[model samples]
Target chain A: MPEPERDILGGYAGDLLSWVMGRASSGDVWVTIMSNLNIVAVASLADPACILLAEGVELDDGVRERAEVQGVNVLRSGKNVFRLCAEIASLI
Target chain B: MADSVNFHFDIDGDNFTSAGEASVMIKKLLRQMEFSPDVIRRVSVAMYEGEINMVIHANGGTADVNVFCDRIEIVLKDNGPGIADVRLAMQEGYSTAPDNIRSLGFGAGMGLPNMKRYTDDMRIESEVGRGTTIYMTVNV
Candidate 1:
């Protein structure tokens, strides 16, 4: 978990990489169901606080390794995107 | 050219997993060189978009980053099916990427626009069959 204590200022939920790349703010908690290697690349460029993988999505070993190498914090939730966003909103 | 430091990478066309490696490297390099966070973000975002475009549209391409005292310049050259319409491609929500790429979370037509949005200047040179070359500069 890189920057474990970093404040989450906002949230963005998108499956489209380009859309997320353009709009996801630096400190936003990015929520998405897309699990791929490219997600790490996007996270690194966007510098999101963390990536919240909704819908109980799991990362493959290769992607997990990449995320670790890139120092991107990733979390998983069985709950859907809406609930995650709601929870994130309530907390931050 | 005399004072600029240049970095070059040959993007691999066949591997979707490796597409943005160059941009990532450049981002780290810029950070190490102590460029402002905003400048680093802008250059990396623009370069990342261009790298993805090359992988998606062209088979592969070459990316060149030149770091100078006042600005950073990026040149992307690809020998693939050229853009049919530069103006149309520049419009948001206008993408030619196939459904497979879209399924992977790209091809929404925001790549070119985002690149233009993050860079100070951008120019595109493409031919119907030969290739496409894009030049972009970000002010320091």
Candidate 2:
């Protein structure tokens, strides 16, 4: 499935979805190790450019399908959380 | 829209995986109804927080959304351990959610505050052992 291309504005790192929803600006590339389906909801609500899953975290069960159906861009990183954040910062 | 449209959903609180289904459905509905992006985003985000709250605190609940010409009204009701202090719960950075919930990426205590920020009107009615009903409205 294809999602609308989003421009990367910046990056936000947080494990708490509610906090990220409150503070992360629209188009920010959200970075987190949390891999729950609820992340799709927060990303949809916040309108982030995409979600970066660090520390080799991957969602389970039907989550990937939900993310695709909801059209939330999710990128996974094999690197640890700190390294992923650093890489995202360099890009932004 | 001339006549009001009502959308009701049963939020499943037994599992964390399906928490935001109601909000997602509403977002699609509002979009198909040709609501502006701003209105749709505000309504959905506020209700999304309320939905998540229902699952986290109430174990399960019902969400009723009324879409009228002038505003969108969301009534979130849950039968669970009711809020002890509405004021304290409304405060930013104050939370009663256990550490386990926090590890799941919610329970940051910004739920109600964020809901209030996005909607034009909000009211909360909760009883200690009975239930909680929250009404939120965003003007079109």
Candidate 3:
């Protein structure tokens, strides 16, 4: 059996919205610096496979709660948004 | 075209984070109703853009979605300070949204153009001080 293709990468909240809506397939991971509940809204809109908060950013409690409810996998990274995006892109 | 359903939602302008809720629900409903992916995507994107606009500009509004066999119609009405220049507002990359909104990752001025791009048809009715109403349609 063949393994599924991976398209892991980091993105800016603004730039990622449209790409996620039109191009990002399900199961793709998204990294961003945004920390508001609107991040969750965009995530739900994009339906990304998972989300990673980079640049040492912290999400509000409300955002975490909602993401949990929606069954979206959330992660935090010590790296900056750009670094994380680069690392993920290398892996992919 | 014979069978049709209507869905209505009150967009809460107070909470920018909750702006796209209606679009999400509509997307799910369309999926359950077995709409084609293209149709679902187009409708959802267009409605989401409109919802965001309502929150960003209107302080909130009402959304009415009429789903028909052949097409889906979405009407977004808001009672906020209306657009002073429809032509300028329609121009891509032109935005009057405050700087704070752009910081939150929206107000790129792409909302209306993207809405128009995804939908089959669109119309805007507005009075500068009164409010604005937008109608969009997607073929199913």
Tell me, by DockQ, which candidate is best.
1
Give the per-residue lDDT of model 2 (tens digit) for B1-140.
47899999999989777788889889999999999988988898899999988888899899999999999999999999999999999999888888878888788899999999999999999999999999999999
**CAPRI accuracy category, model 2:** medium
Question: Per-prediction TM-score, chain A only?
Answer: 0.95, 0.90, 0.71
| TM-score for each model | 0.97, 0.90, 0.85
- Model 1, range A11-74, lDDT digits (tens) per residue? 9999999999899999899999999999999999998999999999988999989998998989
Count steric clashes of candidate 1: 0
lDDT by residue for model 3 (A1-92), tens: 01124344434332435434544544667777767776666666666667778877787778888877655667888897678777777876
Clashing pairs in 3: none
Q: Hey, what RMSD does candidate 1 come out at?
A: 1.2
| Winner of 1 and 2 under TM-score | 1
lDDT of model 2 at position A83: 85
Q: Order of candidates by DockQ, top first?
A: 1, 2, 3
Assess candidate 3 and give its lDDT: 0.78
Full candidate order by lDDT, most accurate first? 1, 2, 3
lDDT of 1 by residue, B16-129 (tens): 998899999999999999999899999999999999999999998999999998999999999999998999999999999999999999998999999999999999999989
* Best of the two (1, 2) by lDDT: 1
